[model samples]
Target: MGSKLGYVYRVLKLGGSLITNKNVPFSFNEELVTNVVNVIKNFKVILVHGGGSFGHYEASLSKENTQTRTVIAMQELNLKILKIFNKENIPVFPLPGRYFTINQVLEILQNNLIPIIYGDILPNGNIISGDDITLTIAKHFHTEALFATDVEGIIINNTAVSLLKSLDDFREIRTSQFDVTGGIREKLRKIFQYKVNSLIFDGRNPTNIYYALSGKRIGTFVEAE
Candidate 1:
């Protein structure tokens, strides 16, 4: 919601790896989403979630589904997420990223309802990444971004680097599974381009979100300073 001080918008992208069983086709981790949402429910957030097993697995030839089918599958998962937030008495306006523009989302947030979005197949049949969703919203609103993945943070030579000041600090990133968006490297590349600092943290720990949202020094930071 807007305040006289103006809304301090934040884009929180819930990684598919954290909220879904990547190994299991179409499987969603409802509990993990619930936990993460519970911790950040109070913030001025524009929530975007990954497709996890749902989008990736469905688009796989093994699943006998194409990108169109994947779109339907992801939307179904979106409904479930809305239900979970509803259970907690949280007001969320679920938006399908492809069809909805960021300004409409601003309208929802202005009305005091959180806007929930996700990675999905667009109407033109392109796979939308959760990172894409987060970046788009962040740029439109100039908000800080947070990517919540399953891992502790971005791992470099088997170590999770806590802060990144430039791309020269790292060389490569590992894609989890069925990821069509070019993985962690792409995410880092785009987020660093923002004028605001971005963060990557483990969503499995609810407290980490609490700490991060409260502006604590947690997770890996991609400093835009």
Candidate 2:
């Protein structure tokens, strides 16, 4: 018999909604992260989280440069996430902009260590959103990537839309309607350009992460044409 197929590697780009709350004050959704980590326990995962309610709110209020304030807030949130992951015996390697480069991401992935990154404004005076980094890392490393967002994967008419399954389906729609940070659409565009397959899923349901990691159909798949 042939050798058994090895486990596939996956990188999950988690949205801010997974950690932070808009309605709650200075609090994180620790329970949600705990639940999600439980669901993802079986996989060899590299997690990238978005700077959620806390970072966005603080950045908006500080009147400081977006890069400065956002980076500081994200660092704090990253530690919070690390604490939760540590409680579950999941080793988290925090990757901030200062420590990240394309080569660094590859090295970490090759070592099978789960690296957690987040969206933040880079010191270069540009928004280094997580979506952008996810695409870059996916292309550079030749790995699969997934985006776990609050929504049910690019919705329209209260239903989930599959933009990649049929590119023509979204050809007429304005790109802005689909992305909040202006990076989701760009991520999809890169998916097409680089011939990489990615997915957008409802992170509120932690089991969806298990399905995605298992190579089962459970989310809106974005694939290269």
Candidate 3:
């Protein structure tokens, strides 16, 4: 691991769709999120989460005060996740995705605190996806990551490839109607651009989260090459 903290380190992104029911506005997948939180409590990694039903739903409907509404929704979901981690005795600190610096994350990690961030609308009102934040942090840390999503992985012709060699391998896939940030397509573009080797796996199964974090090869591995 490239972390100076000297441990098995990685960034983990919890896909919004995995943690919430996108079709149902403000619906949270509490059981799934709780299970994931429990399984990941022992690991030392930075966590990023998407807007899912929370921010996405608000963003889709609110034409006025879009940024404020969106960020507030995202904060609500973020706090719910923090509560779960706290219940597990996991030392998690919530950080704003828009303004959090790399040094802040490093300092938190040095103190053995899990820094959790989520996708949000910037001050300029641009929607930043959790995938983008995950890749950015992973690049700075020079480490691979686990992208936990609702799907098994990148699927083409109804199957998830074990290895994604290039963006050319991708095909159009369905994304949540309320998703303001680009979905899988945007994620793959960032992955390829940053050249951060990462895994895209199903988070619906609680065991898969454990397998991915533990580096057990449970899903599609997007190659850095």
Candidate 4:
């Protein structure tokens, strides 16, 4: 409640696995994205999204020495998302994640415009992961971070680790996907840098998105103490 622009602010990320058919290239889940947007538009939040099939596949190809094409593909995917939010009247302003200065983001928030950014193609010919961007925003804003993923949150010993205190908490969980960026392990490490407690929840069900943002504990909260 510090600024009239943001009554309740949060740095939120929409995982690519939930917004797109990850196994298929260029598959955008418009329906699911729209549904999630409907619920999230009710709050004052900065939106960050991963490039699932869009960005990851490019990153993989670029790893083999084809970089420029990868950057273009990532930009294309970013535009697609920007259009989706704009069409819905979400009051979104788009920016490439790598070049997104904290001052720019804050100015947008100050003016009450929801900034929609994504892991973009940086000028240095590199790609930044959406999760990494979320971590940065969390630290800068000193606010809570939330990630919407495909699973039911970080699982351990056949149960969700409701309160993750350290990286050792996820020692045994295996990732079974073609992840170009570091998977869950990387996500855990990023949030830990600032000892920021973040909320990880399932985005497959739109209701879960609503519940977690409403602070009702529908998902696992990573404790960063």
Best by lDDT: 3
lDDT tens per residue, model 2, 67-126: 676677788888888888788887667887556676666566566667887777656745
lDDT of 4 by residue, 1-225 (tens): 233454667788998878776777778888888888889888778888887887777676636543565667667777777777788887787777767777888878877788887876665656688887887787776777889988887898888867777877576466535567777788888888767778898999999888877766656788874
- lDDT (CA) for every model shown? 0.78, 0.68, 0.86, 0.77
What clash pairs does model 1 have?
A: none
RMSD (Å) per prediction:
2.4, 4.4, 1.3, 2.3
Q: Candidate 3 vs. truth: CA RMSD? A: 1.3
Best TM-score goes to which candidate? 3
Q: Identify the runs in model 4 with alpha carbons over 4 angstroms from their true place.
A: 1-6, 62-66, 172-177
User: Candidate 3 lDDT, tens digit per residue, 43-158?
Assistant: 77799998999998998885899888988999999999999998888898888788677887888788889989888888888887788789888888777878998899889789
As for candidate 2, its clashing pairs are none
List model 1 lDDT by residue over 46-69, tens digit each: 898888788877765555447678
Q: Which sequence of candidate numbers ranks them by lDDT, best first? A: 3, 1, 4, 2
Evaluated against the true structure, the overall lDDT of model 1 is 0.78
Q: Which window of ten consecutive residues has the lowest lDDT sum in model 4? A: 1-10
User: Model 1 — which ten-residue stretch has the worst lDDT?
Assistant: 1-10
- Report lDDT (Cα) of residue 175, candidate 4: 53
